[model samples]
Target: MSELLHLGALVPAAVGVGTLLAMRRDAGRADVLAAVLMLVGMTDAMTLSFVPPVVWFAALIAAGLALAAGRRFSPVATARPGTMVSTHLALGVISTAALILLMPAMPSSTPALVAPSHEHGAGSTMPQLVGAGLALSTVALAVVALRAERSWVHRLHHTTMAASTVAMCAIVAI
Candidate 1:
């Protein structure tokens, strides 16, 4: 389960990195779609971590619905490319943050947050890994985007993807 979770995030990692390499000022809609799909795969990992599967599923459903509703209510009357990209990035980051904050607090981890079922030793190393991934992605993207000549919307994409990539990595790695 651990290995699968790690592998699953590989897609978003690749997409995030690849978008940067593409020099598009920001990623396209497909990137956002792909990243969220990768996030959904964490359902299995959540079960392995002994968290409630139904809750996670419901959360994912809520997120998907929210995204859809936002799209439906857009001023453009249809989802614009920029809106899609930003929405994906926002959802990805929010979901990742949720996972990171909730994991160690689980009933299974109570009284022994790091040692219960964490084969990786539930040590300080887990949070460190998560923090590093999140920090790197967001910081790099922010620096790159602000100095960029693109429009403000492009800047939003840059910040969103950067923050979300790091957040997702942080979440899944834990």
Candidate 2:
């Protein structure tokens, strides 16, 4: 489970960094897909069983930064095709990339989630079903994101992100 959390964290860092640094010029649909997945993965870190409160607070701060960058991203985000690439998108991608890289490397990291005294957290056997649901949602989003292109890609990513948000919400019930 610790390894899964580490891998989960790693996946976003790779995708977000790749989206910003490597794919900035081309703006491929895959790059957009990667960014979206990274964003979700970052938020999903909060759902892990063993993460501590301070780390959770750090995650909130990071989410605020991402939202700020998302706001900055509106220009390029709304620019007419053939006019310009999105500056806002670039900002969002880069800022989030920085965050994803910084988070897991911190000192005094969150404690490993202990097995719940009652029934709670990712350690709960029942919540694995919820994890399955969350996984399914991400998979669906990935499918839609990878399959779509251009304007449709953006739309699909939004829808997928929305679905991912809801599925993630279900995690709290665990």
TM-score of each: 0.35, 0.38
lDDT of 1 at 77: 36
Candidates' lDDT values, in order? 0.47, 0.41
lDDT of 2 at 174: 27
List pairs with backbone clashes in candidate 2.
Answer: 50-113, 73-88, 76-86
lDDT of 2 by residue, 1-174 (tens): 434554444444444444344433335443355455445545544344244334444554455455445535543343345421233333333333333323332223444542222334656554445444544554554444444435543443334333433333333322
In model 1, the worst 10-residue window by lDDT is 105-114
RMSD of each: 11.9, 9.4
Segments of candidate 1 deviating more than 4 angstroms: 1-29, 38-116, 119-126, 165-174
Best by lDDT: 1
Candidate 1 TM-score over all chains jointly: 0.35
Report the C-alpha lDDT of model 1 over 16-123, residue by residue, as the tens digit: 544533435344344455444435535333334343433554555555555546554642333334433434444454445444443443333334323333435556
lDDT of 1: 0.47
Predicted model with the maximum TM-score: 2
Error of 2 at 121 (Å): 11
